[model samples]
Target: MSQHTPPSPVKKGKELILDITTAAFEGKGLGKVGEYAVFVKNTAPGDRVRVRINRKRKNYAEGVLLELLEPSPIRISPKCRHAGTCGGCTWQHIPYEKELVYKSGHVKDHFQRIGGFRDISTEPVIGAPEPFYYRNKMEYTFGDRRWLTDEEVQSGRDIADRDFALGLHVPGRYDRILNLEECHLQDPVSFRILDAVREYALANNIPPYNTHRHEGFLRNLIIRNAEHTGDLMVNLVTSGENDEIMQPFSSWLLERFPEITTVIHTINDTRSPSSEGRYQKVLYGPGYIREYLGPYHFRIDPNTFFQTNTHQARALYDVVLGALDKVPVLYDLYCGVGTLSVYLSGMATRVVGVEVHAGAVEKARENAAENGVSHAVFEQGDMKDIFNDDMIRRHGSPDIIVTDPPRAGMHESVIRQIISILPKKIIYVSCNSSTQARDVALLSEYYRLERIQPVDMFPRTYHIESVAVLSRNDT
Candidate 1:
């Protein structure tokens, strides 16, 4: 028998008016057109918008918001002037309360739909105390091509020098950059430095790096601020080392803002656009700055991976710490720089940290040593390879396992290993809920899902950090 399928209600390049009924994940708005779902960006619930369908699929379609016919009642003015254009903070226009609601709902929906869990215990989301200027780190790219906004084009103003931009990449366009006037994510001093750097580059006639040509004087600028310790670091990534340009620039910058604790110049001779360089030279101060999570202090290098949100990270770690009871031994999987491992060392007699990056492993060892944490040891290798019986025999079996894998989530082999070992409790901390739910589903038979605590680590964005507690089934 041949079955007939109906055609889609919307077509590409067609314009239609829709009343947004609800909010969806990734800062999208959902609306229906005769039983067909359409997704639009930069829209909120209770809004009527004119959308141009750009992508059409079998059941749903994606559109671009062309005009906002009616604004949502709950809509709030965004703090940043670059609100809708900048991709860093997508939900800035929506109220912070509504943003929290959407994030919590998304986590719950992922568990029910992806994990196939009919009934799940979920706690209320913990919102950040200070939503703006909470980021400890900010990365700005140097591009030769500048992206112009629609407003700028319509104004008919004489826009000069469309090249040499020092800001974030335009959404979905890697080669184009939007010259950022102001950003509310990092400290105000960081933006002041950014503007000063841009002025210096322009005055010195420094050309930005071209993605297509791969040749320029400026590459990227990275700033890291220690919230608790008040230490600041500035990392300048360039195509090559030029003492002629760097020496005077560093002196001028330091003279203007003496609060800069350290300055590093990194050289990236490769063609890749990554900010990480081949090697770095310390232009001023020590090569590293110190940060404090709680009572413990950590040395942060230019390339080290630390939590971006310094304030909210304490809240996120509190969730992980609250889920645990004292145990003889604990295993911290994917433990980068041993932050959580060292943090949780107080509750366990011995903690074994496993990470893939050797450099991170070395830093973890250093951090543990710096904090006088003698009971914690870090092993460098892939989780799937190192988490076998041999390693278990070397450093006694774990009573508890805490796994925090990347966005792709844990590998199936790691899941199988956890199931085989069958620890008493598993604390899974994840940044992506969909992948976390899938991993949880894999261990459904051996472990029972207890509850999940969602933390707003990065506010103004769709990203979330959650800690899922699972206990081994007694039966």
Candidate 2:
């Protein structure tokens, strides 16, 4: 028997000139090196670049940008100084107008390539109003060791004196964190809070959390602010819960920022970067803050799931509501915190929102109450398991279903259950187009594609939020 051998690695230090066309699925510039697809990082469509081949495979290759021979006309200067190091805003270099074009192309590509949908019409992406400072929420990490610049390290700075750093993560480096002076994506107040908290922790000798050793005082700092309302929430996440230990810091924050409405402290013993806590307590004021979406007012908790971009979320919700007919009953499946369900409660006679997280359901109910939405109620259980005969009887049948699922999209079982229910309309909203396309393909058997609205919820990022409206197809 003959053994199959792996292809030889492309020689290192190899430079190539490539004419790029469109950005690939992985957010890299796609080019051809003699019929072989080569992905170059940080290059945009219409860019001609000199790149060095770093990795190669049987069918494709990856390159790193060495020099720009010709720059794309749509390219512009990024707002953030840390854009060179931080991974969050990759497309900031591209003009916002052109960014929308590429994002639209990416969505249509997903429907065609993944869902195998032919001639699917995609509307132009709804661009963000303000390209900068649109994010209402921002999280900064604490690191015991600071990631130094070429100048900083060469100047012979002592590691111990400048070791403690709290800022954004350096791309692809787990342990390294670049100290962010300012971030353009979030409000300027968030930067002030970041700096203040860092100074306080440094003076108090609070050690930054070390991911490798799993020991430290401070872990993460999260700031949430309202765009419409001036309400702000500051959440200090630590390794453990100690009221006395957090009392001084929380007191200082409230004293410093008179505008801060709420202060929260959460303890997470786990190693993951999640703010989902082992335990939490309200240090000052209420445990949550208020944010408005349309006429409804939502009380967002520390670990609560709220849309990051405040203004764009409302626009996306508007698109979601516009696609559907006024139905008697609405079912919001995989509903985290019931944002959409509450939004639909005004139009529908009865609204039922189902979520797996009990805490989120509690908050959802609170939201419904806050908005005086008496017609809406929340059900807490696994959708696939609880979405049976009894569950339907309890909540009544849904005339229209709106599912805003997680990035993994809906499970096969959930999809089948939804189809079995056979609602007149299905409004699918997703952050991940790839998984969404798969779910759409499954629903295509019973429902016909009606409208595709892609909203740019996250600007300057490769991510896209698309809404698909489906109507019943009676054969």
Candidate 3:
């Protein structure tokens, strides 16, 4: 196949009768359009469809569903009404069991094909206990326009181009909203609370924030609920215009929904592309939300980073701990708020957590103090700087290293430092499997890939979180 192909006219506005060839680009179904391959959403291998080309790239094309000429046997009707538009669950149309199988293969494929580590043995992907309602965290955007069909728009209903937030933003379009009635990915409480909040906003004449003009009363809403503990945190992203809008909103939420233990507001004045909660204001309850994982209780703020799936997150934490075994001195790199550090402190004689964010480090210290954990220590600095010999002498060379880096994966320098340290065992937890595999390949010289297990942190989405255990190979 040619690496580059000229744009050719697909039938019916670049809509081609294409058959899915294989999985490509984050495990989406791939088909050919002229010489270039087309990535189709909610498609599987052997599926034939007439797809509408959206964006034409040099080597591939992005397409949408026009008509399923011959649907794959694996295709099933998605449960959610907003499945295609919500952007939360792209693989809802694909069977749940099949999705797990495909994800496991996807990780293996990324290592073999992309990372050049063909011999890496991958175990069967571990699935979530409950696929639906597994997500403990959800951040929903507010838009001023409710997306309606052309037929409905023509019926003289004064709806289109009006100031109103439908619900969450559609995949690409920022101006439009998908109007999610209920998301199956989140718990039933989330659905009810979202609906209630939307209704309350509409009733109170609180306008949805316009991303384009940066005007409006409300911008975003985040809901975090713990699975083990029935604790909830609601963070409202607002325009920072008035305290009036929040008084009633917060009052009503606290009174009506007693489960909401932490209700807060964040003033997002900057027109940045970040969805994070900023300049927080406590409306009700405490400054943080609480959750129980095993013997530990975690208090997380709106900006606090907690694993998405609470149940599976515990499992993941256990995997990391098991991989580490019982190292005398351990290091937790990229440790956000030191969740893992606090949990494994008792197991190890001493635990040192290295994080880049100062705020996270403060929170980690607070958590350690609150938990009465004295063996663990948290240092706020770039891991590259903190992993030096001097620091190693002070904290002792980490017998085992447990790092959970960001999606871009660990820095090459950090990886080199890890290899230099030569920890007895390295538990690499990654949200992006491709990057994880790539890093593992780089460390293949010194470390042996003991096991790679894919954990479905975010179900129904293409993203896969994997825990790869690496041990030093004695030649």
TM-score of every model versus the real structure = 0.98, 0.92, 0.92
Report the lDDT tens digits of candidate 3 across residue range 1-475.
6686444545324767889977554647888756667788868777998888887755667888778888788778888877766678878877888888888888888888877877766888888877798888888888877776444568987653355654677767877877776788778888888889988988888888877887886888889988887888888888774777788789899887888888888888878746674588887888687887778888888898888888888888887777657768999899989998998887789999999999999989988888888899988898778777877889999888888999999999899888878988888999888888889889988988889888888888888888988888982
lDDT head-to-head 1 vs 2, winner = 1
Q: Return the number of clashes found in candidate 1.
A: 0
The candidate that wins on TM-score is 1
Residue-wise C-alpha lDDT for candidate 2, range 1-475, written one tens digit per residue: 8988654444456898888888876568899966678888788888999999988878888988888999987678778777756677878778888888888898898999999898997999999999889999998889887888665678896665467888888877978888777788888888899999988988888888999999997889999998888889899989997777799998898899989998989888898877766878888887888889998888787888899999999999999888767878998888889888888787689999999999899989988887888998888988878877787788878888999888999988888888778989999999998899999999998899888899998888888899999999972
Each prediction's RMSD to truth: 1.1, 2.8, 3.0
lDDT of 1 by residue, 1-475 (tens): 9997877779999999999998888889999999999999889999999999999988899999999999999888889888889698989888998898899999999999999997885798999988899999999999889988888889999887688799998889999998999999999999999999999999999888887997898999999999988899999999998999999989989998999999999999889888988999999999888999898899999999999998788888888899899999999999999999998899899999999999999999999999999999999999999999888898888889999999999999898888888999999999999999999999989889999999999999988888899999982
Clashes of each: 0, 0, 2
Indicate the TM-score of model 1: 0.98
* lDDT (C-alpha, whole model) for all candidates: 0.92, 0.86, 0.82
